[model samples]
Every structure is written in C-alpha cells, then in structure tokens.
Target: MKEKHTWLDAVWRILLYFWALTIVFPLCWVLYESLKTNPEFYQDIWALPKQLNWQNYADAWTDYGFGKSLLNTLYYVGGTLIVSLFFTTINAYALTRMEFKGRNLIWGLIMLSLFLPGVNALVPQYVVMRELGLTNSIPGLILLSGLGESVFYLMLLGGFMRSLPKELEESAIMDGASLFQKFWRVIVPLSTPGIVTVAVFKFLGYYNNFMGPFIYLSDPEKYPIAVQMYSANKQMEYTADWVTLFAGVAISMVPSIIIYMLFQRLLMEGATMGAVKG
Candidate 1:
C-alpha cells in the first residue's frame, strides 16, 4: 500500500514537471529568436544567436510605436483598477454582511451571468459604446471596462468575508465606529489576501486585453501594447523582420510575469479562505 502511494506521487510529479516545461520552452524560444536577424532565424530556428543584437529591442520600442502603446496601457489599466477596488469591495461587503432587499436575487443574477458567454454580448456592447461617444477614446474605454461588479472578485471576497466573525464589526460598533469605519478599518485590512489575489488576476486580464482595445479604439495612437502588437505582427509579414517582432512580444510579456511573481502568495490564501471559519 505504501509503495502504491509512493508510485502515484512520483507519477503526479512527473506530469507537473512536463506541464511546466511546455510553458517555459516557448518563452525561451521566443527570447532566443528575438536576438537573431531574419536570415539567422530561418537558418536555425532552434539555435542560439551568433551575437546578441540588442538593436532589435530599440527598433521594437521606437519604430513600432510600442513606447506610446505602453503609456496608453498604463493609463487605461490604472483607471480600471482604481475604480474596480471600490465597487468590488463595497458590493461584497453589502451582499455578505448587510441585510437588504433583493440581495440574494442580485447575487443570483450575477452567478447566472457568469455561466453565459461574454462573446455573445459583443454586438450590444459595441452599440452601447458608440451611443455613449466612447469609441476611440481612453476614458470611454476605461468606463466600459470598469462597469458592473466583477463576479469572481466579489465571490472571492464574499467567501473570505463570510469566514470573518461578525464580532469584529460588533466590537467596532461598541467603540462608536460608523458603518463606513467598520468596513474600511476592519474588513478591508483583514481581507488583504483575497484582495491582492483578485487584483493580480484582474491586472493580468486587463494588461493583455486585446479584443477590447482592438474593437473600440480605432486610432492607432490609442492602442494598448496588445493591440499594437497585432499591428506589429502585420508589419513583420511585409518587412520579414521576425526578430524585432519577437522582441516586441517579449516586451509585452515582461510586466505580467513580474507582477505574478510578486503577488503569487495571495492566490493560495484567497483560494483557501472559504474553507476555514473564524
């Protein structure tokens, strides 16, 4: 019986290692090719570069307009994150702790919407964005992205908040704390893990959001890196400079990777928050 358990563990470990390699290898290949010129790329797709051509990075940054795209992405994502924090936290607090009419019904509707396909709403979303005069505008794009409570974020906080004892709020009340004080002081501080977890997830999503910027933003100057990369991809087809194209792709990947590495711990805590009760 012990031997059976040991063998199963070994098998699982092997599978996990293989999965990790599948992800890591593609990134390594892209980085490798980014250093080579067009001739070198076709000559040996898998070989290392003869010399590191750092100029490819410069061309990707300047010639392709990636510098401008990077700034625009920061503005759009920053606005979305700021607006979302208030809405997600407040909505979770009210639905879980405050007794209000139609609370369950509201939550039920959110849960139901989660199962529906987002692609189905593209036509309606486009029409609404146009009617609001938001198309091709950064502020308009931010507003469209920040609308509605994020179902996953709300659910994560709700589970973690539910596990928290009501006595915390009661104690705050005894000290003459108002409803707003109890929430911002007690609840937000304690629920940091879940908040960070959801934040990392949302950050990655918004950073790599291509479809939103592509459809709504008609102007090339306003495109995020994701959309800009698509345009770069097309240019490479004509220029045949796959090296610089890969460089642009590499630049686009760096931010998300750095952020995930920094806050990965919060994900584990958030995932397990529902199971343990106070």
Candidate 2:
C-alpha cells in the first residue's frame, strides 16, 4: 500500500509540473520575444536575445500611442465598474430578497438571455446607438457595455444572498431601520465577496474590449489598447517589427494581470463561497 501510494504521488507531481509549465511557458516566450530586435526575431524566432533590448518597450509605447490608449482603457473600465456594479447589486438584492409579483418570471427571462449569443443583439444595438447620435462617443460605449445586467454575476450574488440568515434583515427592521438602511448597512457589507467578483469580471471585460470599440469608435485618438494594438500590427512593414508589436501586447496585458493578481483571492472566495454554502 505504501509503495503504491508513493508511485501515485510521484505521477501527480509530474502532472502538476507539466500543467504549471503549460501556463507559464507562453508568457515567458512572449517576454523573451518582446526584447528581441526585428532582425534577431526573424533570424531565429525561438532564440533568446543576444542582448536584451529594453528600447523596444519605449518605442512601442510612443509609436503605438499606448499612452492615450491606456487612458481610454482606464476610463472605459472605470465606467463599466461603477455602472455595472451599481445596477447588478440593486437588481440582485431586489430579485433575491424582496417579494414582488412576476419576480421569478423576470429572473427566468434573464436566465434565458444566458442562452442567447451576444452577437444576436449587435445590429439592433448599433441601430439604436446610431439613432441616438452616440456612435462615436465614449458615453455611448459605456452605456452599451453596461446595458445587460450580467445574469451570471446576478445569479452568483443571489445565491450568496440566499445563503444569508433572514433574521439579519429582520433584526435591522426591528430597530426601525428603513429598507434602504437595512440594505446599505446589513446586506451590502455581507455581500462584499460577490461584489468584488463581479467588479473584477467587469473590469477585465471592459479593459480588453475590442469589438465594441472597433465597431463604435472610428477616431484613432479614442481607441483603447486592444484596438490600438491591432492597428499597430496592421501597419507593420514587410519586415514586421515584431519587437514593438510584442512589447505593445505585453504592455496591454500588464494591467489585466496585475488586477487579477491583486484581487484573485477575493474573486476565488466570492465565486466559491456561494457554491460551498449551497
């Protein structure tokens, strides 16, 4: 039994190592490629740089207009976070905690949206934006992104809210707390984990958004990092300045990776807490 267990443990360790490598290797390769000159990259695409070229990042930053793109991405992400979180939390609270006619029917419709592909709504959404004269505006982009209350986030939060003791709200009411106060003081504080998860997901979606900006924003100055990166790649000459392209890609991804690492623990807890309790 001891011998069998030892063999199984060894196999598991090897598999874990392979899994780790599978994830890390691509990131490492990109980092390496970003430091190589165009000639060096073409000469041996897989070879490590003879001398790490730090100037690649500087060139990419200025030439790709990453500075402006970065600012635009921040605005979009921040707007999405504020708008989506507010609506998602309020809607989730109402759906889960308050008694209302047709509440379940509304939830059922929202769940049905989960089955519908986002692409199906593109033409109508575009027409509405055009009719409103908002096709090229940042506010329009933000509104479009925030229009759909994310059912997945709502459901996750609802499950978490359902797991809470009903007496908590009842006690608040007994103390003469208004419905607003009860939700603000008691429910919101307890639902932090779910809120954090929703915020993180929204942040990522807005930050890396390509299709929305691509379709709606025609002004080069207003383009976000993802669209800007594509523009940079498209303008590359026959020689293909890979170093700058890779650097641009790396810079674009840095904010996402940093945000994920910073709030990963909270996200994990929020995602799993409801499941564990349920």
Candidate 3:
C-alpha cells in the first residue's frame, strides 16, 4: 500500500510540474521577447536578444498609452471592489444567515437565473446604459458592475458564511448587537478569508474584462489594460511593433501576478472553508 501510494504521489507531482512549465514557459518567453528590438526580434524569433532593449517597455508604456489605461483600470477596479465587496457580503449574509420571508425563494430564483445565458442580456443592458447616460465613463461602468450581483460570488461567500457557528451571532445578540452591528462587526471580521478570496478572484476578472469596457467605453483614454492591449495589438498589424506589444503584454500581466501572490494564502483558506468541519 505504501509503495502504491508513493507511486501515485510521484505521478501527481510530475503532472503538476508539467502544468507549471506550461504556464511559466510562455510567460518567460514573452518577457524575453519583450527585451528585444524589432531587428533582433525579426533576426531570431527563438534566440535570446543581442542586447536588452529597455526602450521597448518605455515606448509601450508611453506610446501605447498603458500608463493612462493602467490608471483608469485602477480607478475602475478599485471602485468596483469596494462597492461589490460591501454589497455582496451583505447579500450573502442575508441569504445565508438572516431568516426572512421569501429568502429561500429569492435564492432559488437567483440560482435558477444561472441556467439562462448571460449573453442574452447584453442588448438590454446596453440599452439601459445608454438611457442612463453611462456610456464611455469609468464611474458609470463602476456603478454598473458594482451594482450587479454575481451568482458565483454569492454562492462562494454564502457557503463560507453558512459554515460559521450560530453561537457567535447569538453571543453578539445577547450583548445587544443590532442587525448591522452583528454583520459589520461579528460576521465581516470572521469572514475575512472568504472576502479576500472573492476580492482576488474579482480583481482578476475585472482586470481582464475586455468586452464590457470595449462595448461601453469608446474613448482611448478610458480603456483598461486589456482593451488597450487589444487595440495596440490591432495597430501592430499595420505598424508591426511586435516587441513593444510584447512589452505591453508583459507589463499588463504584472498586477494579476502580484495580486495572486499576495492573497494566495487567504484564497486557499477560503476555498476550503466550507469543506472542513469544525
């Protein structure tokens, strides 16, 4: 049994190493390519650069408008994070813990909506945005996304909230904690792992979101990194500045990597919060 278990573990380890290579290799290749000039890149696609062309990054940053787009993205993403986290936490707490009329029914309806295709709502959403005069503005986009409830976030947070002991809330109540106090003080603090997990996931999604911003934001100044990179890539078809494009692509990946590295522990803890029994 021990021998078999050891062999199984070895196989899993090998697979994991291969998977890591698949992800890391492309990222390293992009970083390497970003360091080359056009002539060096054209001379040898696979070979290392003759000299590090740091100018490509500078050109990508200023010429490609990554600086402005990055700022816009930070504004959009930061606002959405604050608003969505607050609302989602409240909604999850109410759905999972607070007993009220039609709570299950509401949850059931929300779950049922999951079966419907989201693409179908694009037209109506666009129309509403137009009517509300929200198109082409970052704050408008923030409100649109933040106000929208995500089923996946709800489910992840609800599961974590459900796993908390009712005794904690009872203790808070005995001490005369009000409804908002119970949630803001007792629940929010306890659910930090789950909230952080949701935050990291949402950050990735918001950062990479292309279609929403692309459809709504027509101004180049308002573009997020994803949309900006895409526009730059299209321009590359004519200008053929592949190295600079690579540089922008590499720069665009930095935030996601940093966010994942920082919050990875909390993310892992939150992921398993519901599975482990107290």
RMSD of each: 2.1, 2.2, 1.7
Number of clashing residue pairs, candidate 2: 0
* Superposed Cα RMSD, model 1: 2.1
Model 3 vs. true fold: TM: 0.96
Error in Å for residue 28 of model 3: 0.2
Model 1 clash pairs are none
Per-residue lDDT tens digits for candidate 1, residues 185-246, read 99999988888877877788899899889999999999999999999988976898889999
Model 3 weakest lDDT span, ten residues long = 269-278
Top of the candidates by TM-score? 3
* Cα lDDT tens digits for candidate 3, 141-210: 9998888888999999989999899999999999999999999999999999999988998898899988
Per-prediction TM-score: 0.94, 0.93, 0.96
Count of residue pairs whose backbone atoms collide, per candidate? 0, 0, 0
Residue 161 CA displacement from its true place in model 1, Å: 1.1
Candidate 2: residue 12 Cα off by (Å): 4.6
Which window of ten consecutive residues has the lowest lDDT sum in model 2? Answer: 1-10
Ranking by lDDT: 3, 2, 1
